[model samples]
Target: MSSFLTNSLKLLSGAIVAVALVTSAPALAAGGHGRKPVDPGFSFEGPFGTFDQGALQRGYKVYREVCSACHSMKLVSFRNLGQKGGPFYDPKYKNPNDNPVVKQIASEFETAEIDPDSGDEVMRKSTPSDRFPSPFKNDEAAKASNGGAIPPDLSVINKARNGHAPYIYSILIGYEPKPVGLEIPDTQHYNAYVAGSLATQWKGDPHHVPAGGVLAMPPPLTDGRVTFDDGTPSTLKQQAKDVTTFLEWAGDPHMVARKQTGFAVILFLILLGGVVYLAYRQTWKGHH
Candidate 1:
């Protein structure tokens, strides 16, 4: 009986050590952490290795002309584009300073008229303080405008949606006609990622390609609606990339600052960890 008890104790100790080794090995291998890698392809590269202002501006143009009809950017204000302080903008795009053409286009919207002190009607250009004007008078009107589907507000879309900017770009470029031998259900939408389904939640019925390949919205840019001033080919992919980048900036103007701050914090933590490790080793020098 005593021999059996001793063997059991030995086995328990070995199990504990094995469990600790298994768990601690991964921790050590990970160097105390794991982090997701940022997608580099989605990044804009210039002399500063940051977002291109020109691209963003052009993207804004595309959004206003094409996407704006279906999407509303409620969170972003016209003033944000002219902000003087933000990671995305060196000098924010604001009223008066806005491009005359862009301002003219935006001014088509009917906004509130403010009375001056003298009681004269003063029609002012829309500001950031104003809420986005709905395209339709009500939900029923909106549904009627967009077939049976409701166009979603794009204000916080970059922040709220999954797949981030890259996903948005991919979705825009991924739209294709249904292929043969695929029966998309009425409910399931077409997605390139999902297999054997049609009618996705975001788009129309799906068929072939992947599951999520079929987007409901027809290709907005089949021909050249927007030509680059630099004479770069205005491909669908380029359009998607530019617009997605703009949306990303709109979503988080401080992303660059936030990344810089995060890197600094990481470096500080690494230095602190090294110091603590050295002190711990010195204090335990007398211990085994």
Candidate 2:
């Protein structure tokens, strides 16, 4: 009985160690500890807030000129650009496609289509109804082109992280020169914000602690990389803020409407509570 108990204890210990190793793999890869993002104080943060249309529009421009080259936004459609609360929303043009801005934006891209007569694939001018086309035809192609790294879709990126707006904003502007004495693997960029995904480097190196390692994506943003039409300064900081705000808007297009509805509901509940209290007091005035 004593022998059996000893064997069981050993097995349990082994199982616990295995679970811990599996769970800690990701943390180990991302250098185990890192700084958290500070809030950028966006206009759409509070309960009564709304998205800045100008910021969203500029953000869209930044995405189109920079991020669109690598990342795919498959979930977003061209028509969404002109919808209510969107950057290109125009009260004068009820139909999104009819809006000149949407039309011009759509016309800039060439979408893949099949030719009816030859049954061959052909490129044609895109429309407001079409989605933003992928820079790569497929994942394998994207990886092949970009050193085996697949860029994530940005359509719902803001919702994916814990501190959506701030986290992404931090990552955008976080790339820095690697610290002295820190050995980063080749092709890996130093980013204080990006928690890397793989842990193969940590294997067999119990003493070689992680100090923030490789990211497949090289630092993409640089100062003066894009020209803003709104005359916003073309600095890296400004670009990052604009793009991050745009992503926030994309992820929560109905945030303003939702907040408004919530306020109305709370007001109604308060009025109803007051009326109920008055009726109860009047009815029980003599009974009490």
Candidate 3:
């Protein structure tokens, strides 16, 4: 009897631990590589948190002025910016397509249209329905322009990376001076956030191999690179954070709504459990 009780207690403890780990999986999975990612304490981090509208808008500006030079967000349409929960969403515009701000933003870009009468392709101002155009015509062209490195699309980059927004934030501001005894090609720059494998590149002690990886791209952000209309200081960290926020929203636009639904479901489940427990107790009360 004593041994059985001990075993049962151990099993229960193990089950509890397993449940805890499972519940914390999302946070754990969002962690970074060798170097830890800095948490910017974003508004949309916790279960009940929502996207920060100002950050989203500023981030969009950063992408437009800086990142757009190389990277593309092809998955996002111009009208997405004016949709509910988006950066430029206005209550006045129920239809994102008809949103004047979105329309104006789209029209700034020239899109190719075929003239019906002349049967000739002509460059016309883009509409809200248009997707963000790629800077390069093709992958080969992008590679050629970028020294054989094709910039990854920003549309879903936050989702694609393991550390999510934090990892991207870390990378954007992660450039560091190269460590001694670590050799990399001239084309590659060192970023401390990466988990660099130095199996062939390390000339130092095997046990003390440096943490970080080589990047094909140099540091893309600088202080005051973008001036914010809201008067937010355009520091390197701020730009990184804002752009990361925008990328996060682009990657998972429905995150806040999904979290709300999950919270509702959890509340319902808890209430259901309570009701079921009460029913069970009532059914067995007299007999017990």
Candidate 4:
């Protein structure tokens, strides 16, 4: 009887431990790489959805004023910004490359080129065709200035990572001070959405290991970091959402075009299916 009771108690204890682990697993694993991103309810989500031109413009402003300092968007050009699917597109302009706003924005930056007469490097005002300039001459230089961490380029970043648009938005707003008793490495900052791999890049102090890991990027966005020309509220969440939209557009400029094409194709197929069904029914009616 005593042996039976002891065995029963052991089984009960094991069952309790299993239940505890099952219940607490998600709680323990919350807020890391496993963390879920909040949906921004972006304008360009479903099959029929389209990008909001105003939001895109606001997002571009956020990137220009804040993210552009550290992140290079090498693939996007001033010309692309005024092209058909982009936010800045003007129906009145014969050629997007000749857009005055695009030209003005490009002219703000200096591009390096060989001077025809001197046969030497010269800095020249950019044209609409010119790509956005890199903040640093090279990766090593960027790393040296930013505490031994290389800032990733923003171009195609939305496509390169999982969670698509929300991931970028989440990382932008995920910054927080280190939790009590949690050791964060010097020169590193806390961000829940930051991938562990990005933290490993900052090999600053080997001894000053972060409790989980750290992001080399300091909190890049805050309330009112970039004031919108349209007077949208410059909250942290709003900034993050706006910048994410801009990056999404940059990664896939043809997204709207592609969506339109897909929709057209589906509609054509449906109509053809209906016509074919009618023809089949008529032909069979006479035979019957």
What TM-score, computed on C-alpha atoms, does each candidate reach?
0.65, 0.81, 0.85, 0.80
- Give residue 229's lDDT in candidate 4 (0 to 100): 93
Over 1-288, each residue of candidate 3 has an lDDT whose tens digit, in order, gives 999999999999999999998989877754433587777888889887899999999999999999999998989999899988898899999999999989999989987779999999998889999998889888999999999989999999998977788889999999988888888888888888875565578788988777768888888899999999999999999999999999999988888789989999999999999999999999999897
Count backbone clashes in candidate 2: 0
**Root-mean-square deviation of every model:** 8.2, 8.6, 4.6, 8.5
Clashing pairs in 3: 196-212
Q: Residue 36 of candidate 1: its Cα lDDT?
A: 23
All candidates in order of TM-score, best leading:
3, 2, 4, 1
Go through the candidates in order and give each one's C-alpha lDDT.
0.61, 0.83, 0.89, 0.83
Candidate 4: regions farther than 4 A off:
1-32, 197-213, 278-288
State each candidate's clash count. Answer: 25, 0, 1, 0
TM-score of 4: 0.80
lDDT of 4 by residue, 35-121 (tens): 466678888788877778888999999988988898899999989889986878888776888888888888999999999999999
* Tens-place lDDT digits, model 1, residues 152-188: 7766666675556656665666555554555655433
For model 3, what is the C-alpha lDDT against the true structure?
A: 0.89
lDDT of 1 at 120: 71
